[model samples]
Target: MAKKEVLRLENVSFSYAGKKEKAVDGTSLVFREGEFAGIIGAVGSGKSTLLYCCNGLVPKEIRGKFAGTVRLFGKDVAKIGFPEISREASMVFQDPNDQIFNLTVEEEVAFGLLNRGMAREEALAAARKAVARVGLSEKLHDDPSELSAGQKQKVAIACALAADSKIILLDEPVSSLDWRSSQEVYAILSGLAHEGKTVIATEQDTCLLSRHATRIIVIDGGKVVKDGGVEVLSSSLIEKLGLRPPGPMSCGARK
Candidate 1:
């Protein structure tokens, strides 16, 4: 039997306000539950635009004109209520600072829960659990501004996990982290997938994706150029797409 589809994009096209061309065009794909998928491309290849469409954040929040269908868990994203969508999909941007607004780490994670009607105590408990999961228990009371870039990113991940979202959309999640921090983030994402949640990340780091993603979709100029398991991607194709090959660790050998 085939696995169930958790996300579907059909003939989806999106263009920013007054732009002449679509950032993402006629892209069709499906992401299954509990799978880890990565999208890779050059800087202008529309990977970020594709990520925004998965959770109904494109035309709705970004003021773009969209043509096509975006469905999350079998429901049309455009038609779903914002609050309802938030319950199922959570998005973390490249920069954790963009998402962190609360004063402290605990409050930052709990804020989403409280807004969704969870009681304060319940929200705090969830926040603590999430913090501990990301190994940030020691920094719960510290101001988000005071944490290292990596720590702040962990808090952002905790916030997403605390919401209990089934599908998480990450936009270049490790682009801003150091090598060690990037590895740590990947480990956390790996754990999330093992726990039966779907993770979709847009990244330029093919190395991390090769090591951590179950599958990879190569996007170029707003279209999918390749969709397959990492082992199937050729080095020539990686170069043609302007993507770097996986790091030594990702390829299972020491550098």
Candidate 2:
């Protein structure tokens, strides 16, 4: 029997406002529950655009013309209410600072839960749980402005988890972090996947993808050129697809 798909994109295409060509063109893919999927591409390859469509942020926040279908958890994203979508899919952007608006760490984590109609006490408890899960329990009362970039990203992840979302769309989650922090974030993301959440991340670091992702989808010029398990994509093909090969350690010490 085939595995159940948590996300499905069927012949989807998107064009931003004032743009002549589509940012994402005729893309079709499936992301199953408990899968860790990575998207690798060169700059301007429409990786982010594809993620936006998955989380229903494309036609909602972006001024764009969308054609075709995107379904999340068996419901059409285009037809799902924004609030409902928020409950099912949460997104963390490339920049943690862009997503951190609340003054305190706790506030940031609780924002989504509150918006979802969770009572104050329940929301606070959930926030605490999420913070603890991300190893940010000690920073709950800290000012969001005072934390390091990586800590801020952890808070952002905590906030996403507070919503109890089934699908997470992370855009370049580790691009801005230091090596140690990047590993920390990867560990957290790995744990989420282990808990049966679908994780889809767009990354420039193919090494990290190879190390942590169950599958990698290579995109170029707004289309998917390759999609397969890490071992199935050759180093040469990764380079030809405009993606770098995994680091030596990631590739079993091979360069």
Candidate 3:
């Protein structure tokens, strides 16, 4: 049987207002269910922009000269609009501060479900389950502002989980986390993938990504330069595009 394509971008391109070039240029890619795909590139390589496009944040929140198409589960996102698109796709920003606004951890997670019209009791139940999934159960009633940076990120992820989104887009999920925190976060994300959720994360750490991501997508200069299995980490194009080569002990170490 063939894998189900949960997200698809076809010749997609987006140029910000007054910007000379596209932030995401003629990029076309398909992501299937149960995929733990990583997007890696240097600072200005458009990794985040590409991720935003997946969930309709590009043409919606950030205005630009957009072209081509982005679809979720075979439906065009342009027609669905962000409010509707978000029902199946959830996004976790790099900074947890940008996502968590509720009073407590549970409330933060429950917010999405409640907005979607889930019953209060059912939303709370789902929120607790999602919190436990991210290993933040202990902080269920704790203030979101008081948690550690890593814990905050987990709460952000928990929100996505509670929504039962088919696809999760994380932008530099662990960029602000410590080493151990990063590992923990990745473990949660990997678990979600195994549970049949499409997890797409963008990160600058090639070593970490190589170890955890089932597939890698290399974006540079607003375009996808490479897209394949872990072997793409060994491509000279990665280094040529200003991305660090896989670490000495990386799973993608050249054989």
All candidates' TM-scores? 0.96, 0.95, 0.95
Tens digit of lDDT per residue, candidate 3, span 1-255? 868999999999999989989889999999999999999988988999999899888888899899999999999988886667878999999999987788999888999888878899999999999999888889999999999999999999888888888899999999999888988888888888889999999998777777778899998889998899987887898888787877775334322
lDDT of prediction 1 = 0.89
Candidate 3: pairs in clash: none
Residue-level lDDT tens digits of model 2 in 1-255: 566688999998999999989889999999998889999888899999999999888988898888889998889998888889988899999988888888889988999888878899999999999999989899999898789999988898888888889898899998889888888888788888989898899998876776788888988878898889887355587777666677665545311
Could you tell me how far off, in angstroms, the CA of residue 48 lies in candidate 2 after the best superposition?
Answer: 0.6
lDDT of 1 by residue, 203-239 (tens): 9888888778888898989999889987634456788
Total colliding residue pairs, candidate 3: 0
Q: Which 10 successive residues of model 2 have the least lDDT summed?
A: 246-255
- Rank list by lDDT: 3, 1, 2
- The reply for model 2, stretches above 4 Å from the true place, is 250-255
